[model samples]
Target: MAANILLTRIDNRLVHGQVGVTWTKSLGANLILVANDDAAGDELQQKLMSTTADSSGAGIRFFTLEKTIKIISRAADRQHIFIVVKTPADARTLVEGGVPIKEINVGNMHFAQGKTEVTKKVYADAKDKDDLLALANSGVKIYIQDYPGDKQYPITDDLLSKVE
Candidate 1:
């Protein structure tokens, strides 16, 4: 059986205050899954994120792309999972690998070289745009909303064009 995935968010800062506290509380999620390849392989990061999750009264797990694809389907129905990935590409990989993601919340893709600003909180580069477009083509509802209380802006072709 598939896990009850409450939310799939793209935030470079995964499992931080906003995610571990606000999102979990709002969604009533019992588990926060940081499905990022980098975080999954780092022990110190895992420890720190675990501390944050504990403080929020939610369990947390870090998993690589492959591991997430393999294990997420096994999560019990009672596990209300809030998944966070670092980039749109990572989100696409999860969906392609059969993670059952139907929608994606585009959160923080902080400014970096080669990336264009899509929103004050979101920036995207060539590869990011391609991945996002691919996800949209595959029938995923992509939108931008930093916090739980913020307004959601749907990712339309016009918005993607602005990033170009």
Candidate 2:
């Protein structure tokens, strides 16, 4: 059985060209679950996104993690799956909700208002940092990276070292 799930990443852009052309190939998970609630509802947006994310052969399911968690948990015919979350809260929610997360990759949180100190290519706001700490406490490994093959920046250390 191949990996049931391979990569879990947080990228706001979701399934972009770079992601499709790179991450999916690297992680060996062509199937992606985009865990966003609002994005799941807007039919029009979903249609547009689906068009962009579709790799013709690769399978991409854009749905809320809450909706797909059960299905994923039950599936046995192993598939490489990459879960994409929009925010740190969403990632934390999944972990707190009982999803078995081995590792989560923070690709690009980008710069935003109300965020904390910028370090390297990653930025963590209060909520984001709290989630990092929570996951760390729970023993989930986190790697802050910009791209699939990029060097990882451990968010745990970043937060601890910079926290006042």
lDDT string, candidate 1, 62-128, tens digits: 9999999998889998899999999998999999999988879998999999899989999998899
lDDT of 2 by residue, 1-164 (tens): 23377778887777677665478777877577777898778787667656655763457777786876555676455556778888778888888877777889888777677665545556667677777778777888887777766677776654556543
Best by lDDT: 1
> What TM-score does model 2 achieve against the real structure?
0.85
* Cα-based lDDT for every prediction: 0.90, 0.72
TM-score versus the correct structure, for each prediction: 0.96, 0.85
Off by over 4 Å in 2: 1-3, 160-164
